[model samples]
Target chain A: MLSSTVENYLKSLFLLDPRGEKEVATGELAKSLEVTPGSATSMIKTLAQAGLVEHRPHYGVRLTSQGRTLAVHVVRRHRIVELFLVNVLGMDWSEVHEEAEQLEHVVSDEVITRMDDLLGHPSHDPHGDPIPSADGTLPTRTLQTLSFCNEGDNVSIARIGNQNTEFLKFAEDNGLLLGRTITIKNKNEIADSITITTHEKEVVLGLAAAGKIEVEHV
Target chain B: MLSSTVENYLKSLFLLDPRGEKEVATGELAKSLEVTPGSATSMIKTLAQAGLVEHRPHYGVRLTSQGRTLAVHVVRRHRIVELFLVNVLGMDWSEVHEEAEQLEHVVSDEVITRMDDLLGHPSHDPHGDPIPSADGTLPTRTLQTLSFCNEGDNVSIARIGNQNTEFLKFAEDNGLLLGRTITIKNKNEIADSITITTHEKEVVLGLAAAGKIEVEHV
Candidate 1:
């Protein structure tokens, strides 16, 4: 019966350091959660006492193995809920993230398992974000961003690093969907833009936007 | 957003006095919520200040129109979630209630609307409890319990007034499901039991259990 607050903290910790190789600074955690640094420190202390995290004072905080497991479960719930909202409820992918945020805390593992079964055990969500398996292991796929693609390189969309709603809508509008193939026509470092050809049309994207679009060699 | 605590209080109030004609005693409210009388009184005061209830000292409390509307919406969410769990997720009817209790608080109006649509706007939940409309109006159908039926009376199960999980499981085990037709075989007032025939089999039940099974004249 962990509070949603505790779950959010652990989830944020896991996201901030997916490999659990580095401690996240209290200030950075506070900024990510939109809470004051003092509040984050106090919560970190509590989590340390509960053995969910190790607080290294001025160094920062890192989740314990127990905390990481809980955090991965939360992430799994979020991704599953997002897919269910879009694939079953017919909701837009851009709007489901916010809905899934609230639901991930309240939904039961039983319901999540049922949803996963109903969805045919999808490996990825609607946004191409990899869904953690029932055992809490993420898919191990090395992907390169569109920005790093060389001219004439053929690639297919794999995942979207940026989950902003506006960015998702823009991706949908430009037909840059998961599994869609594209060819890098130009990469102008000076202009900070990358031009790609998809669906028989050329689309130009700034380097920042291109970097958010993860792709795999076709 | 109303905390789940506030929503629970409102929901309990509505269930205790569905017609909003009678005021529910503070002691009764406390027992229903499994909270102390002092805690229930304090929450009642908060609800009163918010114009959700009219509290009469030493008498009882009743919901204002605003409060009743909110309570009805919570009920709607609970029933819809219950049906979605049972119908869509293939969960057992007896197990969905606890899951719905947690979910009804966090689920958004948009998701509930989608579920309602997906369920084809079902009028009643799996347990035969009428679902409140989007406008917060409940269906007005008067039904009689099996205990009140005369010997040889023919009726069909309409709703199970008792929502206790064990009772529902017992009902299921005995084939006393909604829409099933039954014929009263005998009424033993001295023994406080009723005998009914269903599926060409005679079953005997205590008056209390019989009283919980609401039925409609066939």
Candidate 2:
């Protein structure tokens, strides 16, 4: 089993440059890890030796195919655990991120398989992130950012952004998660908030929040 | 927050020497972690510095008051995660251990509290191990060994001694688990097979399998 620190490094690297074909800057990785350049330097070298990463010092790092596989596995585990926390454990939507982050690295394929079964083989998590299929194929999506839509356009939420809790609470409070309709009641440019009616409640989403969310034309 | 690896070390120490509060021997820890003595020594030093453990060379390690509190938290998380996997995720009872082991370190107090609520604050996990309450109190009970049970003794599984799939299959085939009730019908002293009636199934539990089970007489 990989250490949490190692996995975190790999996850960050994968997120920055998922396919080994792209090279990430070393300083960027160091910044993302919140570690000194020296520590990141040593660990990246180690990961390269392990064949989990391909690092070219100044040019940065990328996950090898083996490493990408592992990163996706971790991401799938994170999303599955998050959904389980919300849909099954009854956790508040605002609270699943930190918990899932911690759990994603520890659960095994056996546990994940069972989780998938328990969730009725859900195609998406409670937050609208796609749940990778059994074979690790993520469902391809064609979603648009709500901020880019015209003022009167009707849209449906396709995915919620994986950011902080305030955003999640705002989204949940508005019932603007996946498969929910947003009528784009109004866009307030002065205050930079968008008004949308959902589940019979009016939500004033900040332009920043609306920008983060992905939507599809209705 | 302690990492799962660190939490596992603390929990292992807690379980290995629950009564006396004696220091855990390095050799014993190495055995449990499946690492070398030198590796264990190095890690213990790190743990001691981190204030999670106290170490004396020949004497085994022990948890400080702070460490004990952390261990209790990990235990709470593990039991909650296990219950969530089973009750919510629809994961098989046999598959929850590793997942719980990883998740125990990362879940938040909010998630744990809510999980307890969703489960109606279950007092025990699927393995019949008492779950520590939100306040960290474990219900005291004297559990018995199934191997030593006499004829007509009604027993419920407390914890499976091992997590091998073979054990799970056997338990599943016979409808035996943490809450299963069993009445010992006959014990073959020669062939070492015990005939037991569980629910409506008359099953023969081999000595090897029966020996690995811990039970409680009701």
Candidate 3:
């Protein structure tokens, strides 16, 4: 059985380049894991030895066919668990990520496959993150950021970049969730703030905050 | 946040002494974790620093009041997940344990408390293992072993020691689940196999095998 830490490394590596199907950098992995460069180096060596990660100095890390499959499976398990927690268990979307991270490593393939079937091949989790198919294929999507719109352009909040509770609560406090439509009203002359209209409510967000949200045209 | 490993240690300590009100032996904990005595010593020290365990030399380890509470909460999450898997997800008993172990450390207290309410305040898991109440109380049960019965004695299979897939499939093939009655017809002197009658069929099991099964008087 792979340890949760190793499973996380694999997932992070895959997430870095879902289709790069190529090598990834040690520095990028360290940033993702928030570990010391030395520690990431040591772990990558361990993972390489275990055949979960293939490292090439400047080229970065790549999941071998075996590693890629495992990463996909873990991602699939995580998304399914999130769906189970929210759609069935009534847990808040923000709370499911940590819970799913812990469960994805322990449940048997049998349980995960069963959960996938029970969830009816869901396309995305509560946060609007695409759930990879059992075979590692992600549904095609063309997502745009709320900040990518011009004044008076209307769009739907397709997803958010953050799943942290504080962040989701912040979004909720501002009336953001999947399928919530927002119209960009205007941007400040001197500052980066952008104003938006949604659900009969107005939200004033800075440029960085506006960029934190992803949206799709209505 | 407690690492699942630490939670497992606290859990093992608590299980060693049903009353968290007592001390546990280091050797006992080592045996439970299949770790060396030296490793247990090191880990117990770590746990103590984390305020999850208190060690009193040869008397072994005990949970701090805080640790005991955390252990109870972990166990409650575990059994509630087991119940959810069995009752809601229709997962087999054999598959719930490992999943519950992973889930226990990750799920929030609110989710578990809600599930406890949804499961009708179940007193036991599908395997007849006592489910700890929200108050950390184990319901009193007076279950006995099926093998203890003499010839012509009738009993219902209350639980079994093993829930591996092979065993579950074996039990299922023999039409045994909770509430299934087994009446001992006779004992073969040579093989020590007991002839038993079930709902609509009769079967024989070796003495050692039947001894592993727990039962309740009908």
* Candidate 1 chain B, poorest ten consecutive residues by summed lDDT: B195-204
Q: Which digits, one per residue and each the tens of the lDDT, describe model 3 over residues A133-154?
A: 8788888688887767789888
Against the true structure, whose DockQ is highest?
A: 1
| All models, RMSD in angstroms | 1.6, 4.5, 3.2
Model 3 vs truth, CA RMSD? 3.2
**Residue-wise C-alpha lDDT for candidate 3, range B82-169, written one tens digit per residue:** 9888887788887788778777887777778778877888888887777788877778677776666788888998877665667766
lDDT of 3 at B90: 82
TM-score head-to-head 1 vs 2, winner? 1
For all predicted structures, in order, the TM-scores are 0.96, 0.77, 0.87
Best by TM-score: 1
DockQ for candidate 1: 0.83
Which RMSD does model 1 reach against the true structure? Answer: 1.6
Highest-scoring model, lDDT = 1
Worst 10 residues of 3 chain A by lDDT: A52-61
